[model samples]
Target: MKRLNIGLKEVQGVYDGPEGKLWELIMGEQIHIGGFMESMVMAKKAGIKEGQKVLDLCSALGGGLRFLVKNFKVQGFGLDGTKTMFDEAKKRAQAEKVADKIEFKLGNVLDIPWSEGTFDVVWGEDAWCYVTDKDKLVQGAAKVLKKGGTLAFSDWIEGPAGLTEAEAERVNKFMKFPYMESGKGYEAIIKKHGLTLKSSEDLGPHFASCIDLYIRMLSEQLTFDALRIIGDNMEMFKGMGGEMAFMADLARKGKFSRGRFIAVK
Candidate 1:
């Protein structure tokens, strides 16, 4: 999480390395907060059920889609920004035997390759925070959903009062987020997209706990493995620990937040 001179390209390089694998190890296959617990909560709140269609925008490795398909009997497609991620996701689908239930594609989230009104749901995880054009992403999701479908996602966001500019810059550079919105801020965007808001709540407390847990896992239990993952770069590891600690404190204080939203199309 250190803001290493690693810009976007170099950041991508890290993901192609042990850093990305470390994230998967701590966060499970659902590399966002709360894993399947979080996914189940959102699916239930959105009234997702068997036979519904879904389009998972920015769906890394098809984990969330597989979770829904296996649990709710829904079928879906996952769209991600990277083919490397999709390639791994495809393998996961086949290995998990969800290959028949989900498909993975590589494309831009802001400009999906699918036709309009193609899905019953448009879903994302924490990945959307990476997009700079948040409105365009929202519009694309809205455009792709059927009239009676749902739009559901959970994202890393700013809290109700928002982040200080300096804090925002530091967090963005470390987390690779272009910008983050608050629960209130994202609700306004959903309304603008003409989706009926079912629920828009700050899930910051849950994420705070998750971050704290990961810190504990790395610092307390998995130190050796984690050290190997980063090639034993003690300075980088220390920087990441400090950055994560800052994020955890912000989440606990309601400055950095996670926003969960469900909307009717």
Candidate 2:
């Protein structure tokens, strides 16, 4: 299982970039996922309410964590593989005046540092696509959850039958998504662990919209700055553009998608 080498540093770098920074500003709390409003709607539909203890797996810079805390009034604990991201997230939490409500941990998603059944909800944003093992990840999320605890996540997923190896390789190289599973695969894994699948719906059109927005943002907002940073590598820029375009096309046609999955332990 070859995983994408997108660490906390890389993710933070993207989020911290001039264009990336502007993006978060415009997009608000839902930083990484394609559809900010759609993802939030899904989370709310999943029954995440006020004052619940939630574990944010693979949290990067805690944008989603902040959303969960602010809107849902949930207490958030963020777990990320990189200390740098954790530190930055802590800073953000403090800056937002939610420091007392959120805790950041440098840990693995497959082997969470917290004890079992310690949280009312286990949540993730688009970050889970970087994981190599979906089963272990899902199982781990289930482990730390109390009985009837909710597991809600929005992720990039392979379409119905799954992606061809060639297409998978192409997408993985650019996006750093190691294993993109199908909806049925997710259903089977969650069901195997006694979780009731509450919902699994596609948001591919949103991906199409977002990819267009991102590409446009990169051009209008960050081309000069990015080129300066990357030494004006036109080939690299073109490659990235190609990948984004391909993603938009595929997602629009349902060859790939962003999906919201909500389940209960």
Candidate 3:
């Protein structure tokens, strides 16, 4: 797939502004598909143990970090490029009394600020879609992991059937994604970085259902709340809805989807 010109600056604009809030309104604090349940599954599959250090790349709002800290008793460090999200994640972690367990840093994931072999697990959620150079991102993740460490993540990805160039362009533009990687692309990157690919599951059907659920929430339940978040711009709301619907259509066709991956260093 052709990459878009979009990068960290474009992603920061979305998360720092009302568009970010709109996503929170629909996806809740986690802001990813399958939310808590998905996080739990990933943690279990990765064999995350109590007191193990974890780095969450693109850790928007630190929801995934907090979840791990509270549930799995892991020490968490979050790195995100967007200041608004970085600050809010810290605040929320403090408010939830997990501040002591997690630290948030505002920086590019492509150049991770942490030292090599610093973490027992490297984690991400759906947020990695916003990253432009996934090879660099995965390389960074692998570099930060201790020997025998796990890299566990779920991401929005190009599906099995793939997207036409036009379809990919529209979806990437609306989502501010530079590009979506295929499951195989991720597996290759993991192996290229000296990590062993353990598992990769295509979650297209579940992702489509999540999109449908979000559409229903925006159109039926949270219409006014979403409008308020966007400063009550009906036109903008409708436009966003149209784009989301288009994404939903593609997701159903297996052109756009999500993937859950687990690899070991």
Candidate 4:
């Protein structure tokens, strides 16, 4: 698979700009597939007990941590690449009165800043697809976890048969992923990192429904709000709709999917 040469700063700006606003509008505050229900599933599978520390990689806007802390009573530290994201996440934590339960740091996921064995759980959401070095990212997660610490996350990934050339171009051009891994591929990545894989589910069906709902929201419900986020560029909706539909088709066919994994170090 080919990877893009984009830097962390560039990718951060993509999400920090109109693209991120659009995503928030479409995907809600969690910014991942299946939202709160999905997070609940991952947390449960990881056996996330109270008092455990979690390191959330690519924790944009700190939504994942906020959700976990509010529901599970975990201490969460979020590490993201951009100051813009770090600041926004911090602000949201404060606004939600969960600031004491969460913190945000600025750094690339591939080159995380924390010391080894610093956390009980290494968590991520849909954000890892933006990283160029998937192996290094997984290795970094392994590096930060305590002995037998869990790794739980959901990521947008290549599906069962993977993406065709044209499909890859369509997705990459719209989603800005440098590269993606499959669920089966990630099982091997976790195994290579010496983490025991508990379960791996291709949550493509769930994501397909989410995308379908978003398309319906954009086309039928949130049309005006969606337009405003794109700076009122009405024509941009055409391209956006095309991309959404193309991705939805891929999801239904299993070429693009939501891959969820739970593992232990």
Candidate 5:
């Protein structure tokens, strides 16, 4: 895959500003495909249990972290690169009365501050696409996991059919992703880190439907709200919709996808 110039600064800007708010408006606090249902599915597959210590990489708004805390009774730790997300996550945790069970840190996933074997599970949602160095991200996750610990995540990935260089470039730039890995690529990385790959599934079809739902929300039900988040800039709103439509098309064509993976260290 061809890498884009977009990096942490660009990603931080998106989450710090109205664009991030717009995403939350459409996708809710989870901000990923399938949201709560997806989280439940991943949690079950990962075998999350009560009192397990979990680390969430790129834990925007800490929705997944809170979900696990509330549902699985796990203690959660979150790390995000942007202050806006980190602060909001903290506020939400306090309000939800899960503050004691969860901790939020403002830091990059590539440079996790925790020591080796600090967590029983290292998790992520769709946010890892914004990471520029996925190899290091996986390595860091593996390092922080106890022996026999799990690494579980779902991410936007190049689909089985794959994207051409041009298509990949356009999507990466628009989405502020440094690059995307295919499901197979991620499997390789997991194995390279000496983790036992338990599962790798392509959720491209579901991802396409989610994109359609988002487009409909923006164009119909949430049009006014979406515009307001972006400062009532109609041009920007339309542009964003167009980009999303393009992604939806690619997803339907199996050139772009969401991949779910489970591995044990």
Candidate 6:
């Protein structure tokens, strides 16, 4: 398999662009997964509670951390590998007035900074697709989670039949997914780490609808901004658009999906 080369740096840079903010504008407080309430519902179901320590793995700009601290009343520690995103996340946490309750650390997902069984819950948003080693990432989460702790995350997963190498390369290159896994592949990894699978669900509509609406939103509303950014590089924008369209087509065909995994240690 080829590496997607997507990371905190690439994601942060893209998010810094007009398209990035557009996504936030469209996604609103939910980020990219349709709605914040859905994520919160999952968090609540995972037994996240007041004052419990939580780890927001692969946290970018502290979105998930902020939600955990504010809605769930949990103290948060966010970890990300990109220095730029780490700084931005720190600023965001402070801006949200939750910096006191949350700590942003610059680190990789494969290597968590805390000790074994350090947190009550290890939560991730729709961000783990960037990590290369799925098993190691799962094991690391399990290692840092306390006994009875929960490992809850929603990620872009390979659909039931999974992705072919060529298709994987296409999707990964465009979406910045380093690797994607089947739902059962993820289940097996979590089970291998001794975590019990509490629930698993396909979150396809969110992805499919969002991608569809995003393209429409751009075509109808963001044409001016996109032209400004893509000035002199219209071809680059066109190429990316083709890739995005391909992704949307795949989602429509039920060839790719986003899966929400809630597991207990």
Clashes of 5: 0
State the lDDT at 184 in candidate 6: 84
- For each of the candidates, the C-alpha root-mean-square deviation to the true structure, in angstroms, is 2.7, 3.1, 0.8, 1.1, 0.6, 2.5
Q: Write the per-residue lDDT of candidate 6 for residues 1-265, one digit (tens) a residue.
A: 5567666566656555654554455566445475677677778778788999999887776887888888878999988886656787889888889999998888778888899989999988877887778899999999999999999988887776556789888888777667787788899999999999999888776778878887886668766666675564678767766877888877776678888888988
- For candidate 3, the TM-score is 0.98
Clashing pairs in 4: none
Worst 10 residues of 2 by lDDT: 18-27
**lDDT (0-100) at residue 21 of candidate 6?**
54
Best-first order by TM-score = 5, 3, 4, 1, 6, 2
**TM-score attained by model 6:** 0.89
lDDT by residue for model 4 (6-124), tens: 66767877877888888888888898877898889889988998999999999988889998998999999999987777898999999989998897888888888899999999999
Q: Candidate 1, TM-score vs. the true structure? A: 0.94
- lDDT head-to-head 1 vs 6, winner: 1
Error of 2 at 211 (Å): 1.3
lDDT of 6 at 179: 72
TM-score of each: 0.94, 0.87, 0.98, 0.97, 0.99, 0.89
- Cα error of candidate 4 at position 135, Å: 0.3
Across 135-218, the per-residue lDDT of candidate 5 in tens digits comes to: 999999999999999999999999999999999999998889999999999999999999999999999899999999999989
Global CA lDDT computed for model 4: 0.88
Clashes of each: 0, 0, 0, 0, 0, 0
Output the TM-score of candidate 5.
0.99
Candidate 3 lDDT tens digits, 1-265? 7899998999999999998998898888998999999999999999999999999998999999999998999999999999999999999999999999998999999999999999999999998889988999999999999999999999999999899999999999999999999998898999999999999999999999999999999999999999998889999999998999999999999989999999999
C-alpha lDDT of all candidate models, in order = 0.84, 0.77, 0.94, 0.88, 0.95, 0.79
Name the lDDT value of residue 227 in candidate 4: 89
Model 6 lowest lDDT segment of ten: 21-30
